[model samples]
Target: MRGRTLNDAFIILDEAQNTTIAQMKMFLTRIGFRSKTVVTGDVSQVDLPKDTKSGLIDCLEFVDKIKGVKISNFDSSDVVRHRIVRDIINAYDKRKK
Candidate 1:
């Protein structure tokens, strides 16, 4: 079946930390017309194989300079979850350093 164009829509991609750069490119290329796409992930908490690089990380490092692009880096303070959850996230984040 032919795929319909994603025109005049807003798309949020969750759990994108496991996606490779190629996959992210393919997904972004699917957008059409006035669509807005947001790809989100935690680079420090990637679950992919040890040798793999996250697409989200690549974009964070390289794509921000592109015109009309916006990147929002959320911190533990941005968490709306229970206090324990935020603490757990902060703990894990610290372990990565």
Candidate 2:
């Protein structure tokens, strides 16, 4: 029963700013059998208040060694949004220097 058999599924979590550390762990644990998940978020763009910790940031700090989890970093150069966005990011970088 090929059609009836359950197959692995792919899921992508984008703009996961509202998730707390606990929520992230729960979501990761809820993956169905034979499923893969990819979670992506920008820590800097977090909409949560500064006092609130983002799951994405927590995961990055603690889950790097977890099996099947890969961490990749993107900087201002990866900005693919409006031209001014990249420029603004670059300008901020210059200000820090």
Candidate 3:
């Protein structure tokens, strides 16, 4: 396995919408030396209980303050899904206010 070393690896965590705040913190700590984390989840699609806090939700503020963590926010304009998807997203946004 000496010559089988991998140069790059990509780790993607799906259904991250279901992770609790504590689990998210534990997973984030597992990042390897040369590995990077791409944590993607839709807050609007969170599956956690109404009173539960999502790791992805709480980490945003903490990650933003970290020097190397990168945070990106995509809105309706960035929607690449079906047009109806964007419309639904917009509709929800309107109702949240």
Worst 10 residues of 1 by lDDT: 1-10
Model 2, span 1-97: residue lDDT tens: 2223223878778877668888777777666668777888877678887788998888788787888778778888898999899999888789979
- Candidate 2, poorest ten consecutive residues by summed lDDT: 1-10
User: Pick by lDDT: which candidate is best?
Assistant: 1
Tell me which of candidates 1 and 2 scores higher on lDDT. Answer: 1
lDDT of 1 at 83: 91
Better structure of 1 and 3 per lDDT = 1
Clashes of each: 0, 0, 0
Q: Work out how many backbone clashes candidate 3 has.
A: 0
Which lDDT values do the candidates have, in the order given? 0.82, 0.77, 0.79
Give the Å shift of residue 47 in candidate 1: 1.2
Q: How should the candidates be ordered by lDDT, best one leading?
A: 1, 3, 2
Expressed as tens digits, the lDDT of each residue in 2-95 for candidate 3 is: 2232235566777677799888877777666677778888887898889998888888767898888888878998999899988998998999
Structural similarity to truth (TM-score) of each candidate = 0.82, 0.76, 0.83
Error of 3 at 9 (Å): 3.2
